[model samples]
Target chain A: MAEPTPELIQRAQRGDPESLGALIVGQQQYIYSIAMSVLRQPEDAADLTQEACMKLLRVIGQYNGESRFTTWLYRLVVNLGRDELRRRGRRVPEMPPMSDDDGEVIDPLQSLADDDRWADPAAVATNTELQGEIRQALDSLEDHYRLALTLYYFEDLRYNDIAEILDVPLNTVKSYIRRGKERLATILASSESEKIQPPRTVAKSDVPVSQPRLARFAWALGRR
Target chain B: MEHCKEYRTNLALRPDGDTAELSQHAATCPECAKAAKRAAAFDTVVQSAVMPMVPDDLTARLLALVPGLAQPMVRSKRWLRQRRAFFAISALLSVIGVAVLIYGLYILGSYVGVSEIWHTQ
Candidate 1:
């Protein structure tokens, strides 16, 4: 999502209804994507997205512009996601907070890092089978790994931005991505093996890939 | 062989880094070259998987909320407008009523002869 202009953000902070509507409309999809990555269910994600928007409307005046708006918005969504997970009786794993010393020590090798590879959107759009397998694999990951991977690859956030959002050290973000990818690779490899087996009835453990729902409401609104 | 291990570790840890030296090593090493290719392919798949297709109704659902969320603010504006209208109407009616009462009193006094009543008083 394009970052809402600073003027728009300022207007929103001052409780301008048009600006607030624009801001929320622009961010709704992004919020939903983050929610889906965390909750792994469409209904839950949708509910979370609505909750976040409502919460944003109520608390937008409190925004101080001390950080990037997206960063602040991300923190909001992440916190809400955490709370929702907790409400569902899921354990939101706590990573150690970044100490001042840890925060100050930036790795020289990390400075040289260029881990910005992302899937080509056109390519991803066509690879339905691989996408399904990957989604299943992602769904099975722990919350931390899933969240880091989603923010890094999908949101295209830098490691430092992710660290700020996740409230962890920079190295911790890297560790999550690396370990997350490793686990994903392992899962995909195993799934590939299972796919090669003789045809059998669908098992209870199998999950079907969810179909993307087209926004009929959006289309209707546009026509109006 | 040692370089191969280092290259693979770097590939796994930081797949898309400024790896000019690593690329040079991989070019000379067949095993590392194959490893790099596989790693690239895997990264692509993982990225595709992690990025979800957001539901279509999400934006509409959210925008639908904007009006409700903004209702309290809107309600206050409407109330203020109504209050201002009420006050203006009240003030205008009061002025007209007072003017009519004064006119009627003046007409009564003129008919009754105010000079005669003042003399009697």
Candidate 2:
């Protein structure tokens, strides 16, 4: 979405109802998208979107225009999302440890070995099932990782903006996104294994010799 | 091997980052090239998955909330004016009521000789 013009923002800040209405109208979809990405439920996301609009109305005057307006707005939405999660008694889950006791970084891609299934850009780009798997994996991730990835990938936000919105350092933002993608790849690989495995009682007629051998080997290796 | 690790790490962290140096390294290394392809694929899938269609009525619903945007300041000013007028009127009435009560007490005291009782005591 295009950023609202400075004139419109100034008018809105001056309490011009028409300008405020226009501003909210322009940003509602963007707000809802972020809310949906965070909440992962249609009803909750919708409620959050409306609530965010109300909040913007109340706090528009407090915006000093030091940062990009959207960045400020994103911080508001993220904070609201965190509050909603807390109200529901769901603490934002902590990111899984990135290093072991030996202080060595655990490389998430180490497990993939020679498996190039996730490495095929064309397959991922065209496959609907893989897209669904990715969405599911994203939903399962911890809040910080999910938020970082959502802002970076979905909103096309820069690392600097994401870092500011997340209130973390630049490197931390990168770590959240990097680890988030790694975790997603891990989840997708496992789900693919489950789908590829056939029943033990399958007849020879049902089995393609080459297909099952490769499937079985990939599945076994993925499990290991 | 360490160079490959750095290349892969950079790819995983930022598939879209400026990678001229990394690209040069990947050109010489088949393993890093494969990793780059995988990172690109993963980034595509993630970008696709994270985007959701905004609800149709979201704009209308949010715009409806805008009417009250300027109302609070207007309403608060009017409220303050009304409250100040109210307090002033109440204070006047209170002063008048107190004076009347004191006058009535003095008259009753004179008629009943209660002031004399106090003076004598």
Best by lDDT: 2
Error of 2 at B8 (Å): 1.4
For candidate 1, give the docking quality class from DockQ: incorrect
lDDT digits (tens) for residues A1-224 of candidate 1: 45689899988887776788889877876787788887888999889989999999888888887877887887899999999889989987576443323322222122112322222334544677876877887888777888887777644466777889999988788777766666676676667766667654433334234422323233333321
- The lDDT, on a scale of 0 to 1, for candidate 2 is 0.75
lDDT tens digits, residue span A28-128, model 2: 76777678777889889999999998899899999998988888998899889889988999875453433212233334555554566666888878888
DockQ of each: 0.17, 0.30
- Local error of candidate 1 at A28, Å? 2.2
Off by over 4 Å in 2: A1-3, A16-22, A93-123, A154-156, A200-224, B15-17, B68-121
TM per prediction? 0.63, 0.68
In model 2, the Cα lDDT at residue B22 comes to 68
Best by TM-score: 2
